[model samples]
Target: MNREKLPVLLDNEIIEIRPDQSLLTERYTDFGINFINNLEKDQPFFFYLAHSMPHVPIFASENFKGKSKANVYGDVIEEIDFNVGRLVKTLKEKGVFNNTLIIYTSDNGPWLNFGSHAGSSGELRGGKFDVFEGGYRVPCVILGLM
Candidate 1:
């Protein structure tokens, strides 16, 4: 597999990521919260939080690890849930909750090769690779201004 050289940009600056280091989902949470907090009460904003976990090489921050009954995968999902709660709270406090819309989704089914680290397709047959429901019918939750 040929991997393309992609740049990681933050604030218009490219940065390096350590291969051994885990990417915490909390950063995405913080970014969304900060983005919402900085906006004016009447200002319209759009924040798209695409979490990279509950997938492969899954990770939960120190605070979330060992807090879930399922495993690391569950912990990552829990952390994501916590972040969503924080975003909702921020939106409500900023008086934009009623008008704001939040959509949570995944690009594909769970990767099962990692054993305990993989997520469940839940009642669906097959997994990330097969043509069954588990392969294509992943979970999606939509909240706010529905």
Candidate 2:
């Protein structure tokens, strides 16, 4: 693996990440766990986790396999949900649950026409692009905070 191949400029700094774990589908929760586990307990902290779930590949994780009634996509969502639940549980276990702030959401509406694994924007118009309601409209869930 060549380190130079994965370089990017961020805030005037060159940043690099190994490609073996570069799947957009493989980020978020997978890396988030590491971040949370290494947190220092003496100071209050903020952790924002965004999942790339129910997104592309529509792959069902092992625990969620054959369980979702909505097919492959649904299973992926359940996996996302499960991982999030795990994070919450971990916080509670650490006695920081009440002091934590958790906000859950998607970056955009469901993608369309990228193979057969399209997602609905829940009564919105159009897909990920377009200025329609769907493009700018998506679900947002707030949890564990003010």
Candidate 3:
């Protein structure tokens, strides 16, 4: 195995921020502020904020606990939607919303067995681990940029 560039795990400072938990957004919002502040202002800032949600252990934020068209998955999705909206809202409020490029994506398929907690992993076979559409099939959405 190629271990020369193996990452130095920072288990000490890395705290578990569950997506379904409110702490996740708090953690993200804190870093989001820092991220914007760190931008040089003259150069364009490219940001990619990918957070796990509507996945497993489906836990919705306090505000969206019981609000949604879907079930737990829907509630979780709405929570994710809130975060995405917040990012855009921040950008717009800062007047840089036009120059920013935002995109959201998922890595793999959902665990069908996860029942409603799982997301639409696309129509493939197997799941999480398999050489089927259900495994590697995924899509991306691009906005604010070509």
Candidate 4:
């Protein structure tokens, strides 16, 4: 199989030619954390963090790689979870945790063709390109802003 080449872009410009994809989750989280940290306490801001992992050619940082029993796929998810925790901690430290609104969801189901490298849609039939419920069904979580 041919490995996909992914590039890192900033402001619609390529910033790095060969960024370590494994650290992308942490990097995205850090960007969000820093943005929040530098904001005025009373100022309203919006931060959007979109991760690229858990997709084809998945990867996990050294801290998370090989740390899960569910193989590389699990490692990638664990890394995402870790970064999300860090983001939440930063929000709480900034005293905006209670007022912040967090919405988390996947764009689509996993690619079942990748075998263990892809996520499971549980008992849902089909995935990704298929027209079954598994292809469109996804988990969504909304928190805070109460």
For every candidate in turn, the CA RMSD to the true structure comes to: 2.6, 4.7, 5.6, 2.3
Model 2 has a clash total of: 1
Q: Pick the candidate with the highest TM-score.
A: 4
* Clash count list over all predictions: 0, 1, 2, 0
| Residue 57 lDDT in candidate 3 | 58
In Å, residue 77's CA in model 4 sits off its true spot by: 0.6
The local distance difference test score of each candidate is 0.76, 0.66, 0.66, 0.88
Model 1 per-residue lDDT tens digits across residues 16-135: 444222344776678778888899758876777777677676777888888899898888888888888888898888888889777778877888788879888788887888798888
Report the number of the highest-lDDT candidate. 4
lDDT of 2 by residue, 41-136 (tens): 856776665554566645665666777776667767777777788778777777778887787877777787664466776667787877888876
The TM-score-based order of candidates, best leading, equals 4, 1, 3, 2
Off by over 4 Å in 2: 1-31
Candidate 4: worst 10 consecutive residues by lDDT? 1-10
Q: Which pairs in model 3 have colliding backbones?
A: 124-133, 124-134
Compared with the true structure, model 1 gives a TM-score of 0.85
lDDT per residue for candidate 3 within 1-146, as digits (tens), equals: 34343222223553432222544644565577667766666667666665546556567777777797767787777877777777777777777878877777778877778877776655457776667788777767778757
